[model samples]
Target: MNSQVFQTPIEYLKGVGTARAEVLKKDLGIFKYEDLLRHFPFKYIDRTRFYKIRDINPELPHVQVVARLTHKEILGEKHTKRLIVHAQDDTGVMELAWFQGIKWAEKNLVIGKAYIIFGKPGMFNGKAQMAHPEIEPYSPEALKGKGNVSLQPGYNSTEKLKTFSLDSKGLQKLVAILLDQFAREISEILPQYLLQKLNLMSRVDAYRNIHFPENATLLYEAQRRLKFEELFLIQLRLLKSKLLRTQKFKGNIFGSVGQCFNTFYHDKIPFPLTNAQKRVLKEIRLDTQRGVQMNRLLQGDVGSGKTVVALMSMLLAIDNGFQTCIMAPTEILANQHFISIKQLLGDDFVEVALLTGSVKKKDRKIIHENLENGKLKILIGTHALIEDAVQFQNLGFVVIDEQHRFGVEQRAKLWRKNTIPPHVLVMTATPIPRTLAMTLYGDLDVSVIDELPAGRKPIETLHFYESQRLQMFGLIKREITLGRQVYVVYPLIQESEKLDLKNLMDGYETMSREFPLPQYRLSVVHGKIPAADKAFEMQRFVKGDTQIMVATTVIEVGVNVPNASVMIIENAERFGLSQLHQLRGRVGRGAEQSYCILMSGGKLSREGRIRLDTMVRTNNGFEISEIDLQLRGPGNIEGTQQSGVLDLKLADLATDQEILLQARKIVEDIFARDPQLALPEHQVLHYAFASKNAGLSWDKIS
Candidate 1:
């Protein structure tokens, strides 16, 4: 592409004056002339055919009609008022209404003059009407550049942009003017040989067709070419980063698997390791043995033995005469890990300590000292572990639990704790779809524990409406009578008009009424509750002191009680699929069979109904994750949203798995042949990457 033209400011464009340029820049991030060229349309409309007024229907998509206006009038008053123009073709008349720009329409639309109008049709009182339709004179001059077979592009715009006439149509005009001036200068980026091999369109033609296609075939090819290029670059960048890190970044070599890991594996393991766990451990062992820093993501559903895998990974560091630390998102989780790990180790296997803000000053100082002197073999804590005072003697391995909760910078802090970044293993209970993992954590090695521990039963999930509350209550009573604790979760702390779900407090009060004081002991926890209080309530539930716990999603991540047999989620429709899955994981942790009772209103949205049905159907995290990705897209998933990497122009991780795989394979071959992309044919690819990622940090997805 022409560098000078692309780098030129938008204000220099023919149609975009100073005022319009400011709006484009602020509202749409369109700063340069090329920005307009690359701003592809979200949808397209066929302009080849015009529909007669009598043939128009609301079921038909956006239609074009060549008609003459028979009458015009302004109806209603104040906010309800609108300008309506009656336009007639050979067969019948249709209403063209404008809710805004009434004065402009009244002045520009001439009565008894032929015009071309295009808009989506709707019914108002049994009459076909179009609101805010595009109107132009029927003369050939009015549609000079728009050809007979052209498909008009419709860009996404904000209301602010519409005020300056920079809506979809307005944007099309600016883009057309720029193309007229600079089409020749828009040189191709993908060279001719590769273009021929892929059967892809030229860069210039792709851009033009992506905006206004000549036909259906051209539009499809244009979209394919653009999506391929975007995904290819992202894959190439990710593979390059992995290469650089492995080749240059130094890692501590755990030369030996010593007694700690052996003893735990042989004598202290609570249960036998699943095949998935054993495989992941083997992968980790191979990575650490390679003498390069390891950045790996350990993803599994809750109760899939991820914690055990993390524990063994930390043991590898300890056996190598190094200290390791685990950073959890919450203090409750940190405490739980500290306690459970000690129990799992069977006492005095390795000196483990917990460090958090709640730790007393004296205990904190000693813990800090032990960490610096390398006496504390393993340490676990919340964000306080990253404080300046918490220095380590040799932080060889680091585990970040619930890795999505920490931002890239926060996780990077642990890397900075030591001179060479530690062999890092980031763990999450949320199962990420394979496509998403390729893009978001593409540079990191991913190991999935796909199987649960032996002899564990899958939680039976059921969906219920409010009218079935009596049956739900009966089930809950049966579970409590069986001596298993229960959890009733709500979605909110206070009621709002926007969401009519039950609040935690109200749910607690209602439960108290249902199972009064002495018969049933209940504890409640929510975001507003004090930390000490929350911990106390959770401990009571864990101890089976309370028959049931009433709370919000605060208990979603932490406080794992194996004996909690029933999980009742009030207004479960309000949660994302992933969240609902996590909440269900809170139960079914023990030997006994557990159940997740999902309760919501009778009227559920289409997506909500699908989510509930999905939960009731299967407990496979991967399957649920794929469905979640399809329903919510990649950005709304736990971690990818914050990275802003999902600002993809065309490629979708949910639907483009094959394209992503091909891109990755091609990149692998390229790297195998030319390690640094330093070859004759690779020069364009190199230059394109450099221009796009001038100062982009390769390791920002920590």
Candidate 2:
């Protein structure tokens, strides 16, 4: 490409001036000629087939017609006035109306003259009508010049941009001007061999057809080429990061499976490891032993025994004469992990300590001393572990639970603790879809423990309407009588006029009335409650002192009570699929058959029904995640929306998996043949990669 021509500011364009350039930049992020060139249309409309007046229907998305205007009039008073025009074909007549721009339409439209009209067809008062339709003077020469193309590109514009005459049509006109002037300046970025092997279109032709195609076949080819390049560049950058990290950063060599790991595996383990768990462990072992810094993401569903795998990985570090730490997002989670790890060690001799903001000043001093003196082999805590005062003697491995909750800079702090950054294993209970895993954590290796431990049964999920409240209450009572606890979760802390869902306080009051205090004890927790009070309530529930625990989603993570056999989510339709799944996982921890009762009103939206049906259908987290990705696009998924890496203009992770996989495979093959891109044919590829990644620093990290 001619860099100077492409990088020219938008104001320099023939039609766009300073005022319009500011609006374009602010509304659409179009600053330079290149930015406008890459802005592909969202959809296309067929304009080749002109519809007759009698054939127009509301079911049709849009229609184009060339007809003669015979009648024109203005109706109603100010604020209610509208321009009404009648256009007639040989078969019938249709009404053309405009309310906002009536003056412009009344002056510009010529009666008794032919016009080409295009817009969405609708019906008003049992007659065919079009509101604010596009009108152009009919000319045979203009039609011939357009070549009668079937597809017309439609761009997206904001209301602010529309005020500056930058609507879809305006944007399309600007794109056409740029293409006509600088189409020859656009250069190909892909190599000739790869293009021929893939049968891809040229870069310049793709850009032209993407904005203004002569035919549908050419449009399809243009889309294919552009989507491939977008995904290929992303995959190339990620894979290159992984390659460079492996070659540049040397890791601590854990040469042997020493006594600590062996002892825990043989004796201290409470249950046998599942095949999935073993597989993940093997991957981690290989990564650490290869003498390269390990950055792996461990994805497992709730109660899938990921904690055990994390602990065992830490033990491997201990056997290599190094210290390790586990960081959690919340204090409650950190405390729970500390307790679980302690219980799992049983009679083992590995030293472990808990550190958090709640730890006293004197106690923190002792923990600090032990950490620096190398007495603390393992430390489990919240963000306190990343403090500069909490230095380590020789930290070799680190485990981060719920890794998405922490920012990139926070994780980098742990990396700086050691002269040579420790091997990092970031864990998440929220299962990520395959495509998302490739894009979000592409720089890190991924291992999944896809199976639950033995003796655990899948939770039986049930949906209930408000009319069936009594039946749900009866079931809860039966479970409590059977020596099992219950969890009652509400969506909100207090009542809101906008939403008709039950709140936590109201539900707690009703529960207190339904089951008297002397007969039944209930603990309540929500975000508004004090930290100490929340912990007290949680402790009471954990100890089985309370027969029911009514809380908010704050208990969604970190709380594990085996005896809690029933989970009742009030207004279940208000929660997301992933959140509902996490709440369902709170139960079914014990050998007994557990139940998750989804309580909602009688009416449900389409999306709400799908979410509930999916919960009742399967217990597979991976399957649920895929469905979630389909329902809500990649931008709406939990952690990825803020990453800024998913700002893709053409390729979609939800429906373009095939293209993504092919792009990844092609990128891998290219790297295998030419790691440095030093081949004569790969010069274009190297320059493109370098230009795309200019001034980026994240590639140096995980």
Candidate 3:
């Protein structure tokens, strides 16, 4: 039978009896031959050299000793079994202690026998001691190619697994058994030309070497091949999805939004549309009027005037007598959008309504009645917008603000609200790098508002060590005296009180005491506070009722107090660059000049220094995001909360951005020449795609 068909315990393999198999399954997750083959080592131990006993230091954590077992002694009562052995190397004498299985340990260590012991050396009663160390009997086979061993496989196991008898060596033996027996010469998935061009190893070679490499160079090569396979498959999936979309989904083509723009520009609007706003609106207009359904991502830095563009797009749907829904992630943001849209389109007497989870039952009933009857042209709400009870009259378009926070399934569900899937426009203040935008959103067209509105003053940023606390406080006070509000933000960690690490509670009390004045109203807000109380405090700050507000990173996203001009971030080093930039954005939204004071701790690491320096140098979110991607990598951005993303195992989304582009090019070229991958030469590529797309067999699903 083919080895692959042995989908049972490793112990069932030819030489592995039930006893060893029990140990294999317990110590390792290897239930099958394939599982054993893929169980790669965590790290390796080098036991090449042996030191003289006299040269040994008790304080040293680990040491290699070549010695002769001088004698063995049993100590302690029956309840506490213990065995002590004495050994001598060229340099000095060392003691070996064993807690349990004393008799077995004593039998292993024979008197006047030379052997090698690898273990941690420690002080015991002012003498050197090695406790239950790894002892291997002296033999040419055991020390073969002395000091040449690379990485040793460390199989994952639990205490129960260990007791059941499975260990790393047992797992390794089973893996070797599988490799020698069932391992097949699978067809290469990648084309020969592409493999040579990319200098990649074949699938079988990569799978083998990734689990059990001959050396470091082979290991690196294997890893590179695996990473490439993962990324290539991801690109293929996206392209396939895009193909399906274009082939199956038909778009709703509306008349040019150009006419409504002219009307708003000439007669209906109060203020002149910002040049940046006009540019983005034109892009949206072009996208909507195209034959294809518009799936566009609208990205802008904070305060870059994206809201106006979103409003204008909705106007296009409204003018065409179709309905539009703007979905925000939270009620506060939804309410904010409702207020802004109401002001922007009021001249046309367009009926706009806000629907949130907390809307009164009576009010919701009225809103639902108006919504189904086509009386409401635009409905702005949070997740409540997608409720089954609320049906749109036409639902021609969907606008998702701060779209990254929502999942793909959630977005898809919202799109399904319309009979013919609505044209989608996703808006975000977080500026993602363009390369990431292409790979992650290849199905969607992307338009960026790169420029801020004219006449907006640049926010000035400064960095300070803890020593400059007094001076930082003075700057905040000065800003407050100038009729601008000050925001003091604290850091959140696991838990700490003595160090006082500038938590929100500490900052709130300090502000209340240090800056206590009848005129200075200090409002406090933090994550621990109830949503209602937090919103109340935030509103107070927005309305200028509170001159200084102390908050946590909870203010990173939605608190819009344009009147606040000074942002003081305590323990700024603890915060990420993109986040600090977002906090800085809260200020400088209005006419007043804004200042951001970054109060870091005593010393900063190289990364911390770079983050602070970057903040001080520029307020560009895109640049900061680029730096963040470089420093922290993708998993930081693709948390579990951000679902349906391509959670690539091997691809470094930032550094390998160029690779993504190359993969896309290759996919397009290959498909254009051989769309079905039916060419004999392309069959390998087809199999490779299938193997990877079938859900990576090697990857553990967490």
Candidate 4:
């Protein structure tokens, strides 16, 4: 057997014809002989020993017993037909039955014949039973063929495949045939020197042992080799892409620290930058001076001063005679940024504009003219900033806040706004754990602001039952009396009879009745409302015209209201830990001590209790994110799943963080030695990399 034989269609294999090949391809995505070989077993069972029928119990995983069939019968009608056979050992007897493949079993099975039966043992109606067990003739060759030292491999199959005798045992037989006929043609992927350096098993031997290993030790070694290969290749591809992009895309050099940046820093400074903020600024400054496009992921917890860092970076771009833009996920967030930036840079130095979907056409026209003419120094807005009509004059730096909300294509549109892509600084308040960041944003340099600024008190979080609504209301009243507004956030917008949850509309009604008219001015906002109405309500809340703002999760991202001292989250358990953290951030922005009261039903699930306990125990967003990752694996986390980054078959980024680090280090070292992967020793790697990324272009939203 050679390369051509390895490329042979699987239907040409013995015992497989056109129909079986079609079922195999449709059910399991196996087309050619190589596909069958690559279909690895998920688990294995030892078949060196057999258990007696009397020794078999429901607690045992899987057992093989030598038994004689005493009786055979087909019972029930048509679809309900069951082939039942009572199998007896010397000490005990058990019933073996099959509902599917009944006709095949009935035609093949004979009465009073000794067979080696293998299956899981379970108690059915107070009697031991083995349903749809693997049966073979009782002979020495049959016992030997079962394997003496090798573990039996289990294959996954579908119901359609099982109808044609292609269950695990059938598929295993097919794999065993391929192994016996063509183990020599499995091909080598890793170089001999590299394999020796890593002490990994040979590629062909690894493939053989992975399917049917001689022992547990061999299986472990085989899995290690395969997982390392997979993870190493992925990390290598990402690191190489990063290296190429850095060399290819040139960035605008902000060579001067002009008066606008210096004056704002020294004269009109609102507060001193924390050590963490200064450290991050140094990193950004170094990136801007490097003359290569800087694609960086700036991660921070809520209230960690990510906005100030973004502002200073934007000012740097302006000082260098280049325009900058800040793209926020929502219109509310965009307006907040616009107002905050305007307040911070109120001097007659830089002109700032706001662009969002709600901006009037006349204002947009003027903003467009100023932008094209390079008069606007800073433009802060939502997705509308990336429209075709929106153009920029030397857009040097882009700061995308809450970057995960925008798709990669939307971000790419912003990149195309300039000839050489603008220096990208993406910010997210959701603290991505180190393992997640490695996989999700591996192509970007990461900088984290782990410290909150001084003089900002940690928000006090407390848990309460729904029965104590009056107590919570009293606390909210006390906060309001202190000249502060409050946010009453409900998880649902409308009440539903099916769910045991509070609705925003009903809560607003109850609040109005409790403190009617002028006594308590309230503003209502929700996702279902018009954008203008929501903004109006939000503005009223911001301006202190409304004492209370009732809303849903629409305010989860970037709602900055310092006067809102109290945040009452209804049915807090209904939201995720990350979402709850963002909502808690809405308050505690002012100098006064803020409180986040979590009100929920008395009955809480285990996970819900853990979430609330974590919230109450710590104010650290990174700790909360780690716990959330453990509770719900990376797939359920908000942004990473949209891209195919976490579509892993072997290595898990959640638990295999150490392996990921090792794989990344290995890639770095390999590239350090051979930058182009052109050496003869690295030909295997070049082949693997090329094959893995065959038709996939490396273009991305840097």
Among these predictions, the greatest lDDT belongs to 2
Give the candidates in order of TM-score, highest first.
2, 1, 4, 3
* lDDT of candidate 3 over 223-265, digit per residue (tens): 7887676677776766766766866777777785556555766
CA RMSD of all predictions: 3.4, 2.7, 4.9, 3.9
Which of 1 and 3 is ahead in TM-score? Answer: 1
- After superposition, which runs of candidate 1 have C-alpha atoms over 4 Å from their true positions? 68-114, 122-132, 137-149, 691-702
Please state the error at residue 510 of candidate 1 in Å: 0.8
Model 4 per-residue lDDT tens digits across residues 295-342: 999999888888889999989999998899999988778888888888
Query: Which segments of model 2 are wrong by more than 4 Å?
Result: 74-82, 124-127, 141-149, 690-702
User: How do the residues 373-468 of candidate 1 rate in per-residue lDDT, one tens digit apiece?
Assistant: 888989999999989999999999999998878988899898999987899998988899998988888889999999999889999999999999
Pick by TM-score: which candidate is best? 2
- The order of the candidates by lDDT, greatest first, is 2, 1, 4, 3
For residues 1-702, what per-residue lDDT tens digits would candidate 2 score against the true structure?
455687789999999999999999988999988788877799988877888888998999999999999999999999999999999989888999999989899999999999999999999887889999988888886475383335788999999989988899899999999989998887777899989999999988998888888778999999999888888888888898888888888899888899999999998898999999999999999998989999999999999999999999999999999999999999999998998999999744888999999999999999999999999999999999999899999999999998888998999999889988899999999999999998888888999999999999889999999999999999999999899999999999999999998999999999998888788999999999889999999999999999999999999999999999999999999998889989998999999999999998989999999999999999999999998989888888887876766888888899999999998898889899988877889777664555452211112121
Lowest summed lDDT window (length 10), candidate 4: 693-702
The TM-score of predicted model 3 comes to: 0.82
Q: Name model 4 segments beyond 4 Å from true.
A: 1-50, 59-62, 73-83, 138-187, 467-471, 495-500, 510-518, 691-702
Provide the TM-score for each candidate, comma-separated: 0.93, 0.95, 0.82, 0.89
